[model samples]
Target: MSWTLTEEHLADLARGAALLGTGGGGDPHVGQLLVRQAIREHGPVLVLDPTEVADDALVIPTAQMGAPTVVFEKLPAGTEPVAALRALEYHLDRTADATMPIECGGINSMIPLLVGALTGLPVVDADGMGRAFPELQMETFSVYGVPGSPMAIAGEGGETVVIDTRADNARMEWLARGVTVRLGGVAHIAEYAMSGADVRRTAIPRTLSLALSVGRAIREARQANTDPVARLAEVLADTLYGHLRVLFRGKVVDVERRTEAGFARGRARVAAMGGATGQLELVFQNEHLVALVDGEVRCVVPDLVCVLDAEQAEPITTESLRYGQRVTVVGISTPELMRSPQALATFGPAAFGLPYAFRPVEELVPA
Candidate 1:
């Protein structure tokens, strides 16, 4: 089924995508504002289920590349994504059939939608990562063998570059990161152009709806004066994404954050606020990578480590984590696509340079 994405869906979509972002993926406010403006002017963007496209159709993933912090400070020029998309199509010499998200977290979730709104293209319901990862190579598209180049990147300053990094997406990221830094920290990108058949086979399906449901659940819970965190967990459990567990609930006591190498890198310490007499440490590189409780690993990557507000259930990005704020640490299993051997090799605990092996949230904290 296909439906139009109007101003109404933007807020909820942003909320849920932020949840799936773990602790990073840039902020959604800028994307939301730009998309809302586009929607208002262009009527509504159409979002199609993955099954709706033809087997041979060409799909391009639209996204932004840079430190989330940098983009936050230096807003997009609104034309950057459109510039990237057109540049990509010109290079391919084929008009794109649809737009897809590189990931379903924060700003990424809305970028394709915004592009679709502007281009009259249908945005695919699927995304490369069921959640967000800091690097381009970590996407399931790459794990499933989609080449990351012949990529197009458009800067806010009217500059654009078409990159052909051949088979290495890490190289694509390295090259793109350099461009983004030179662009003064943020630019729009379109890449991993693939066939509809391949997208259906590898992409995490229906995750946009999943993000919407999560955002809606939080809104409804708050409206009813109920437990928004529990509502969010229920929303996740409905998908194959696995259950949610509260790893810790407390007040943040320490934060070590810095923007280095065009990424937000840091660790946050949360001390138990109530009867629980312990503290938890979260390590991140743009996104929260692991959660350690009393010096033991409680949750790690390839799974979600969500840091949400204790009362409002709002997701806290790595850059926003500060001292003395009450927050709840939640964990959920990633989509199966993200847990495959190929994906694990790219993004599992070892990929994050952690010394321990990867463990599912369910195993670390059994139901």
Candidate 2:
């Protein structure tokens, strides 16, 4: 089924993206407003079903590359993605017939929507990571052998840079991070130009709908005076992400954060609230990567460790975490593609320099 994006759906999309963001992809507030602005000016953008896409059609992925904190301060000049897309089109020597989100998370989720509105291109109802990951190379496209090159990145100042790297996808991220930091800590990136056939195979299908459904479920649950957490878990059970488990519910006790090498790397310590004993600690580098509960490693990436407000159920990003905030930690399984051997080698806990063997959250947690 095809759907047209209207203004009313914006909130649900933002909320859902934040949930899938798993504590990274930056705050969605700025992005929500930007997408709303674009929609209002350009009319409703069409969201195409993956099956509707032509195999030979060109597809482009667009996202902001940088620290979420700096993005808040600098804001988008609105034209960054356009410039990046134009540059990528020039380098690729082809116009994109459609656009897709690099990942389904927070601000990044909204970027592709806004681009679709601005460019009059349909936004594919799919994304790279079923959940957000910190680095460019972490996308399933890279794991599936897609190159991140001939890439175009644009800054707030309107300068555009095209990158061509064959060293490795990690090197692509490394070079892009360096450029992004120099571009004032945040820049618009358009890369992984591909055929619709490849995108249809590699993209996490229906994630946009998945985000909206999760968000709408929470909204309806709240209105109906039900348990939003349980409702959300039930909502997720029907999606590509098989389940969402409550990892911990507590008040934040400590947060160690630093903007090192242009990435927010740190941990959040949450102690059980409401007289419950013990604590849960989350390790993050932009997004939550690991969860250790009561001294046991309960969940790790490529699985998602999402942190939401205990009362409201809104996700809290790594940079936004602080002492004393009440939060509920939840975990979701990564997309099946991301759990493959190649995917694990690229984004597993061990890939993050953590000494744990890669294990799916579904396997690590009781069924």
Report each candidate's C-alpha RMSD, comma-separated, in the order given. 1.0, 1.1
Clashing pairs in 2: none
Model 1, residue 228: C-alpha shift (Å): 1.1
Clash number by candidate, in order = 0, 0
- Model 1: how far is 62 from its true place, Å? 0.5
Highest lDDT: which candidate? 1
lDDT of 2 by residue, 180-256 (tens): 98988889999988888988888899898998998898888889989898999897887778877788889999999
Give model 2 RMSD, 1 decimal: 1.1
Best-fitting candidate, scored by TM-score: 1
Tens-digit lDDT track for model 1 on 54-160? 99999999999888888768988889988999999999999999999999998999899889989889999999888888888888989989999999999888788
